[model samples]
Target: MDPLILGALVAVATIAVLFSGVSVATGLLIVSGLFLVLFEGMWALELMPDKFFGKLNSFALLSIPMFIIMGSAISSTRAGADLYEALERWLTRVPGGLVMSNLGACALFSAMSGSSPATCAAIGKMGIPEMRKRGYPEEVAAGSIAAGGTLGILIPPSVTMIVYGIATETSIGRLFLAGVLPGLMLVGLFMVWSVYSTWRNTGLSVMSARSYSLREKLEILPRVIPFLLVIVGVLYAMYGGIATPSETAAVGALLCLLMAIVIYRMWSPKSLWVVLRDSTRESVMILFIIGAAGVFSYMLSSLFITQSIAMWISDLDVNRWVLLGAVNVFLLIAGFFLPPVAVILMAAPILLPIILAADFDPYWFAVILTINMEIGLISPPVGLNLYVISSIAPDIKLKTILKGSMPYVGCMVLAIVILCVFPGIATWLPDLVMGPVR
Candidate 1:
């Protein structure tokens, strides 16, 4: 069989299985396995080496489990509720203040958790009800939570960044550092949009002026300060060369455990057990997907599809900007149908070559690709964030969530454009902090 035909068949089969409601992991694994057997014959079985399993046994990948454990421990301990309570006391005085606070809390939680679903589940539970009780529209409340949840992947210690770094062999520390400025930029954009949207509606009420004495505000900081410390500590260690990215994750995880146990006193053996078990489960799922993706990527490389695509892309008589735009459009369409991880897995292999061939900055392209995937999280038909929000508020129509998410989506597009035009915005911090890329 022509390798290209085989590649197309594998792609179609994966999608067909996904649409048929089979588990994504199972679908990916089965499709890859079948392709190997069918295309490569019996020798394909023999070619499945021990090193394939060994690839998952990386010390760097250890960060995934540690971060997941930390996230679960934090989520299970009701730490998010404390953070929100502390934030609400301070921010609730402004118009749509609670929503702003929700974004703020989500940003903090995203730094800690690094998973969108966990962020959504943690913050949405509290934010949605509070917004509704405060007379905010359901669409606005749900949209804020869903959009805010996306911060998880953009912030440092992000699992997505870690995965990207690992897959591409880019510096994980640099990738983490790269995310900070862009992440904060997105947060600011979301806040501005949230404020503007609430202002335009006029149906929502702002908090009445209730003075909090200096002492009261000071009191809340004690609760909030620890979260900030954890983030700062991790970044400081990484930036100062005190620890590698994996080591920073370990230290951060230990601090998270201590915060939950000693400071909050929410840790029990049972709770700790649950956190470990849940983290293990989630980590296994991620690793499996990654492993299967590795296999598929290997198969694609074996078939020369990546080379073919890169060659074809290079042959096109287009300027760099046009090529970048084409890549964005392709990723956007992929996002509508594929999970972010899958999109990253499939597209990164093909596109990275094209990017390198075109002399594009890898870090800039990574940020651009990440932002595109983030937008996909809110896009129609299959936006993961939309489904997450819908699951929380079943009565709220998907259309409302779609409409509400548009502003944030627009904000994301604007951010992407800024990064494209001013690659320095994404690259400057990384270069300054990481020093000139070798």
Candidate 2:
């Protein structure tokens, strides 16, 4: 069979299997296995073990579980709840203050968590109910938190970035540094939109049930100082040359554990077991998917499909900007159905060559792709973050959550445009701190 035809068959089969509700790891494994047998025969099976270990044996990827443990440990505490309560106390007097608080909390939590659904679920569980109690619109409350939660993947220490860096052979530290500005930019954009939306419509504002004095407001910091310390400590360790990204994650996890046990006094044997179990489960799921994706990626390279696609696109002689725009649009559409990691793993092999051929900075393109995938987390059909928020606030229908996320989707698109026009927004911090990767 022609390699292109084989590629098309694999793509269609994978999509069909995924739509049939198979897990991504399962679908990719099944599809890749069948194609390998059909095309390459039994001898290729000999390579599977090496491939699995190769994918799992990354020092940098070790951070996924450590960061996950950190996030889970913190989730077990009152950290998220206290952080939001403090924000509410301070911001309730401002327009769309509660919504802003929700976005702020999500960004702060994203800095710690590195997982979209985790951030969405943790913040949404606290923010949505309180927003409802304060007479805030359900759609606004749900939408903003869902959208804000997508920040988890774009920010530094992001699991998605870790995966992308390892897959692309980019410097993981540089990738982490590169994401900082764009992540903060998205946070500002989301918050600005929230405030503007509330201001134009006075109906969105609600009087606080009680007010806080300066002393009380200042005291709120103690409740959240531990989390802030973890974020700062992790970033400083990585950027200040004290630790690798993976080591920073381990240290951060340890800090989060100590904070949960010593400071918050929320850690018990049972709770620690639960956090470890949940972190293990999530880490295993991600690694399994990456292992499966490694098989599919190997098959693509063997078939020369990635190189073929890149050559075909280059031969079209299309303007590079037009090609770039089209790639973004394709990724945006694909995001609605595929999770970000799947999209990155599946698409990067094919797309990155064409991007590099166009003379685009790999690091900048990574940030752009991260932003696009983040939008997908809240998009419908397979919007994981939307489902997470819905599960947390059972009263808010999925459709309402989906509807609410659209405006923030616009904010993401605008951020993409800004990044495109000024690549420095994504590249500057990394360039200043670590120098360029490419």
Candidate 3:
């Protein structure tokens, strides 16, 4: 059978299963396994274990579980509440100040937590109620939290970046550094949109700017300083050459536990157990997806499906920018249905070759891909962050949350355009600090 025809069939099967509500990991495994055996025969079965295990058996992957644990620990503590209060105190004078504070808290928490739903839950619970008390619009308040939560994957210590780096064999540290500017850029865009939208709408006069006393502002710092220290430590360890990514994760997780127990005094034995249990479940689910994506990636390579697609793209004689734009559009659409990790795991194998063939820097492309995934987290229908915020604020309908998030979605798109036009925004920091990842 023609590989293209086979690839088309595989694509159709994948879409059918995914749309029918099969888990992404199961769908990929079943589809890839069936294709491998059907096309390559029994001998290919001999190589399956090595492919799956090889993907999972990496030093880099160790960081994933640790980071998840750290995130879970933080979520189970008072850190989110503290951070929210601190930001609210500082930013309350700005237009849409409380919403802006939520965005700021999301960005900072994302730097610590590395999970979108976790970030949303952490800040949303605190921010939404606070916004409500302040007479902010429900859509604006919820939308800001949901949209800002997507930053979890774009900021450093992001699990999505780790998965992308592992899948593409890109340097995780370089990827982490690469995300810093783009993440901040998205934060700025979201803040600007929130401020402008609330200010422009007369109904939200309740969002008028107001300042806090200097002493009141200073008093909140102690609440946030412990959390910020963990973020700073992990980053310095990783980017400053003081530790490997895995070591950095280990130390960060330990600090999170200590903060929860010693500093916050929020951890009893039962609470500790709950955090452990939840983290284990989330970590196992993600690692399984990684392993399954490895199988699918290997099958695509062995089947020459990815190579065939790349060759076809190369043969088109189209400009690289056009192809890049098309790929970003496709990813944005796919993001509505798939989470960032699955998208990276599944899409990276197929897209990376074509991207490198066009002479685009892999590092720069990783940042672009990440920003695209970040948008997906708040996208309508299946966006994880939307669901997370909805669950927290059960009275608010999902449609309203989606409606409020649309402007911030525009902000994300604009960020993508900026990155495309000036790849330097993504690359400059990594180059200056890490010196180009060798």
Candidate 4:
């Protein structure tokens, strides 16, 4: 059989299995192993153990679990609620201020946790009820946090960016830095839409449930400021080259745990166990998928499928922007099926070379890909975020959540276009701080 044909079959089969509800890591592993045996014989199968080990052996991969732990520690506590409350105190006077605060809180927590579902679960648990209690529309109330939670992968300390850096051999610090501007840009865009939509749909009088006194506003800071500091510290360490991504993650995780203990009094053994257990479970799931993806990539390369695809793409005679548009569409669709990390692991290696050949900056492209994944998180079929919001706010219809989120999805699409026009939004910070990539 033609390798290209087999490659197409394998790709389609992976999607079918994922949609069939088999665990992503398991499905990828089974597909890779079976295809390897049938296509390359027993000897090829035998080599996979060492191959998968070599792939997973990276020290940088350690950051993923630590990042998960950092997120889990906060989500397992009232810190997310604290973070949202603090934002509301400051922003409550503005129209749709509460929702804006939710978006802001999502960005900050996402920077800390680096997991979208955790962000959704954490902030939504508080923000949704608060918004609803204030008489915000159910769609706006739920849609805001659902869309905002997608920031987990766009903000710094992002797990997906870490995976992309590892897969493409790009600098993790640079990728984190690359995400900063675009992340902020998206936050601003979301806020703008929220304010306008609230003013239009609800009215200018809309606000939080009540106002806080100056002292009340200031009091909450003592509890949440330290967590905010954790975000700043991690980025500073990454930006200053003070530590590697893994070391940064380790320190950030420690600080978050310490804060959860000292501030939230989450020091009981069961609480600690819960954080560690949740983090470990998610970490293992991601790592297992990564290990399997390593095998899958090897299979594609061994079969000449990867080369054929890259060459086929390279040989296309189209304007670079047109090619870029096609890649964006492909990523958007792929993201709807796979989590950002899995997509990065499987696709980055294949796409990075093509992106470079097209004269697109790699870091800029990372932001663009992330925004696509953000849309995926809020869309259907496999929109993890939609279901996450549904679980948290059981009363809000899923279709309403989807409807409310649709505008923000358009906000994301607009963000992508803006980044394309000014790629510097993603590249300038990294270049200015680290010096241009040679």
Residues 39-84, model 1: lDDT tens digits: 6786775554542575586789988888888777787767787777
TM-score of 2: 0.95
How do all the candidates rank in terms of lDDT, highest first?
4, 3, 2, 1
CA shift of 58, model 1, Å: 2.5
Best by lDDT: 4
**TM-score to native of every candidate shown:** 0.94, 0.95, 0.96, 0.97
Candidate 3 lDDT by residue in tens digits, 70-113: 98888887788889988888878765778888999999987787
lDDT of each: 0.80, 0.85, 0.86, 0.87
Candidate 1 Cα errors over 4 Å, as ranges: 1-5, 49-51, 203-205
Number of the top candidate by TM-score? 4
Backbone clashes for every candidate come to 0, 0, 0, 0
lDDT over C-alpha atoms for residue 395 of model 1: 76
Error of 3 at 198 (Å): 0.7
lDDT of 4 by residue, 1-438 (tens): 887798899888888877888887778877888888888897888877777788899999999999889888888878888888899899888777888999999988877777788889989998888888877788788888888889989888889898888888899899988998899999999989877877787785667367779998999999988988888898888778698889989999999999899998886999899899988898988888888888888988888888888888899999999999999999999988888888888889889889999989999999999899999999997899999999999989999999999999999999999998999999999999999999
Cα lDDT, model 4, residue 400: 95
